[model samples]
Structure formats: C-alpha cells, structure tokens
Target: MKNKSGSFIEWLIPFCFILCAGWLIWHLPAFTLDWVPPDQSQADNLRGLHHRNDVTPGMSGPFGGEADWVDYLALLGLPIFLYIGIRTVRRAPMEFESWRPADRVSVFIGRVTMMMIILLTSVMLYEVLLRYVFEAPTLWANELSLWLAGFVFLCAGLYAMQQRSHIRIFLLYDICPRWMQRLFDTISTVLIVLFAFFLVYGGYGEALDKLWRWETFGTAFDPPIPATLKPTVLIIVSLVAIQAVVNLISDWNAEPVIHTAADDIDQDELEKIRAAVGAEGVGDLDVTRGSIQGNQTERN
Candidate 1:
C-alpha cells in the first residue's frame, strides 16, 4: 500500500506538468509577464515574481518574487519525472562490477538526464510541427528545450562517475602496488572532494541570493534559469563530491586491477562473432568460396 501510494504520486507529478504545459500553451495570450509597459521600468517586469522585493506591488512577501505558476510546475515536475525514471532504469554507456548506494543514486540521476533528452527533442519537434504544419511557432519552445538540456548536461557528470565511465589515465596508477593504488585512489578522491567543496562553497552563497532575491534570466518567457540553475549547480557538485567519497569507500577493499590492451576488448562479443560465422581452427572455412562468389556477383 505504501509503495503503491509513492508510485501514484510519482506518476501524478508528470501528469500535472503535462496539464500545466498544455494549459499555458492554450492560454498563452491570457497570461502576461509584461505587467509593466515598455515606457516604464522593464527591468522590474523582467525580474517579475522572481524578485524577493515588492516588484509587483501587492504581490509581495515570501512567495512574492518567485517564478510564475507554470514555471513552478515545470521546475517541480522535471526532477520527480526523472526520479521516477531512474527507479527502474538500466545501465548506460558504462558498466560497474559492483553497485553502491551513491552509484545507485547517480545511475538514477543519469537516467533522469536521459529522459530529459527525449523531452527536449519533443519540445523541438512540437515547435517544428506547429511552425510548418500550422504556420505558427512558439517562443517558449526554444527556451524550454534549452533549460531542460542544461540539466541533462550538468547531471551527466554524476551519471558518468557512477557508471565508472569518467576518463582516467591509468599509466602510473595501474602499475602501482596494491597499497600504493589505494593511496593513489585516496589522494584522487581527496582532490575531488576539495574541488567539489570549493564549488559548493562559492556557489552556495550566490544560489541562496538568487533564491532569496528571486533572480531570473530576464527573457520574454522569463524562466527562472538563474534561480533554479544556481541551486542545481550546488546540488550537482555536491552529488559529484558524494559520489567521489562513495568511489573511495567502494574501492577501498578491492585489489588493484592492472589493465591491458586485452582488458579493453569485450571477450563475450568476440565469441558471438565466431559463433555466428561458425569459426573453427585457423584454416577453417567459415566462409565458402561459393558464398563469396555469390556475394560478389549478386547484381550479375
């Protein structure tokens, strides 16, 4: 019963997003961020509700300068939509011999980013169809797609780390003894933590400022790109840091794996090829002369 309730809520969020997006597109004219005229202060209008100040007069207090209703729906929906996705998703480009809690979280976040790819493409497709088929194009589509793509790119680092797909030159570390390898790994993780901490430390202040001040990108749609994205940077960097720590812990007990040229090859893949061609010994005729002749003279 508990699991069922959680699943329902998870699916409900995306449904709400679809409804909100559809409603906004339908009632585009009724909504207007341009509450102020061009002759007046345009900056305040650009800041809109995202400002922490009384930019919109009576529209002040705690939720005063935040993004619009639809923007809120979009912001809230995307993460949950992705959260649902990673819950039952599979591995991506990288494979891991063992999975840790952090790896699981990163894998889930990675899948969420993958979901954003489809969503971003879909917005573009919607724009194309609307412009060509109906002779109308949306101004919001491009910005929406850009916003989604940003999250996809940022979250990808965490996904890569979780998958063990991030680039690493094993030249020196590979040849080290088991103890030395562990030491190297520890050193590497410490560096990552330090860097990650630095980012979070720097970005945290600005991110809070953005959220508190309700900053925005000041576009026509005026999505809270800065307001949302700033916090996301802190969150993403923190996740990366956590994953680094996770990697250090997970690999702590492992033996040093000495990589070779052969380690790169997928051995199971080679056997599949041999089996398909019925490959035997070196002189084995997996391909008959007749088959080759038939292949060469197919058009003849």
Candidate 2:
C-alpha cells in the first residue's frame, strides 16, 4: 500500500466541505435573477405573484403547497448529483490504452452543446409564437424552461470532472516516473478533501441566515427563489463532497489489473483500476482486441 501523507488531514477535507456547504445553504438566501416577460399583456397578470404583499388571503397555487413540495424534491437532486460526481472522478483512471484523446472533450462538449442548443431553440420558439401569434403567454412554460437551464448547468460541472478535462499543469507531472506521479495524485486528493470540508463547516451559517427569511422570487413570476433553491444547493454541495471521499478510497488502492470476463459488470472498471495501480500481475485488457472481436461479430 502506498503510504498517504497527513492521514488525519486527508480525512478532514471532506468533512470540511460538508460543513461549509451546510452553512452556505442554511445561511445564504436563494439566488434570484431578474425575470420579465417580453410581452406586456400577460406581464401584468404575474404582477400579483411577483411581490404582492396583497396575496389573496389564504390563497396558494394549485394543489396548495404542491409547488413548494416539488421544489423541495428537486433540491434533493443536488446532493445526489454531487455524490455521483465524486464517485466518477475518484473511480480508477481509464487504462491509458483504453482512452482516446478526444473522448474527454467529446463527452463534455456533447452534453453541454446539445442541451444548450435545444433549450435556446425551444425558449425562442415559445417567445416568438406567444408574443406575435397567440398574443398570450403562460407562466408554467417560462418557469419550466428556467428550471431546465439550472439542471443543465449543474450537470455540466459533474461531467467536466468525469472527462478529466479540467485544467491542470503538467510541468512536474509530465516528467515524473510512475511512482512519483502516484505520490502527487495522492497528495492532491488529500488537499481536495481537506479544503472541501473546511468550506462546508465554515459556510453553513451563511446559508442558514438566508433560509430563515422566506425569500421568494421577488417578481411577478413567483420563481420560489430563496425558499426553493438554497436547500438544493446545499444538497448538491454535500454530494460532491462525498464523491471526493469515494475518489480517495478508489485511488489510494487501485492497480493496473485486467478483467477478462465476457459479461459486463458494474464494478469491473474499478476492479481493473485497483489491480493496475497496485501493480499486480494483471494489467489492463487490450481494448483494441475487444474492438476487433466486436468488428468480427458484426461481419458474421
């Protein structure tokens, strides 16, 4: 086993990230950007929802409290996402031979560009038709579009990590031998955990302060600003923190071994990593060989 430095400090990073994220969520107010529909006809309709202290006495959206409930559930996705991200990053590096130079960039761009284009087109189409043709607009469509945008932004970060396409300097790592490279990887991971933990613990108070205010969209659109998204942000941050921990575990003991079972297995990739990193007798499978077999099968 490669000896990891600063054992206590290594564990501390993830803890800190969790604590800081909690503080941020609990103390911070929901983020709200100004939103005004282009058309004026239906814009007035939303005014009451925007900042109406004149809320009809005992009135709420359809399925009373249903919207809020949905918001709460949506918030849960953040943590779940972060958890997935950390797991993906910490998972064993692909066997070098298994990787293509374009793979990382391709995945990153494909997800972002496709989603952005589709959303932009849809939003523009809605606006043009609603304003010029129908002369009417709906609140649900606008809000739903914004929500989709938010989700797309969230997934982008996680996907970037997965591709290992994030910026890094190779001045030292480029020339380092295998063992030395491993040492640096271990150290960097430890710092990541430590920093993440500290951020969470220190920032939790700030998040909570905002939550207590019952902040809303502050616009006619009633976006559910503070009350909705703050909680979700906290959840997302915590999940990302957990992934960091899983990453440490996966990398600290991985090896370069190959698994030859025909059946695809969920953990098969991770197992291969552990063997290779551990420098055991097994090495990475020849993906080239697999590709050849696949081609042959297609011809047959």
lDDT of 2 at 18: 36
Q: How well does each candidate superpose onto the true structure, as a TM-score? A: 0.65, 0.43
Q: Please report, as a residue range, the 10-residue window in candidate 2 with the lowest summed lDDT.
A: 27-36
Writing each residue's lDDT as its tens digit, candidate 2 over 111-186 gives 3334454655687688779977998876556664664465455545544543444466766775776577678877
Best by lDDT: 1
Candidate 2 segments whose C-alpha is farther than 4 A from its true place: 1-124, 132-147, 252-300
Clash count for candidate 1 is 4
**lDDT (CA) for every model shown?**
0.63, 0.46
Which lDDT tens digits does candidate 1 get at residues 153-176?
888988777766688898998777
Query: Taking the candidates one at a time, how many backbone clashes does each contain?
Result: 4, 55
TM-score of 1: 0.65
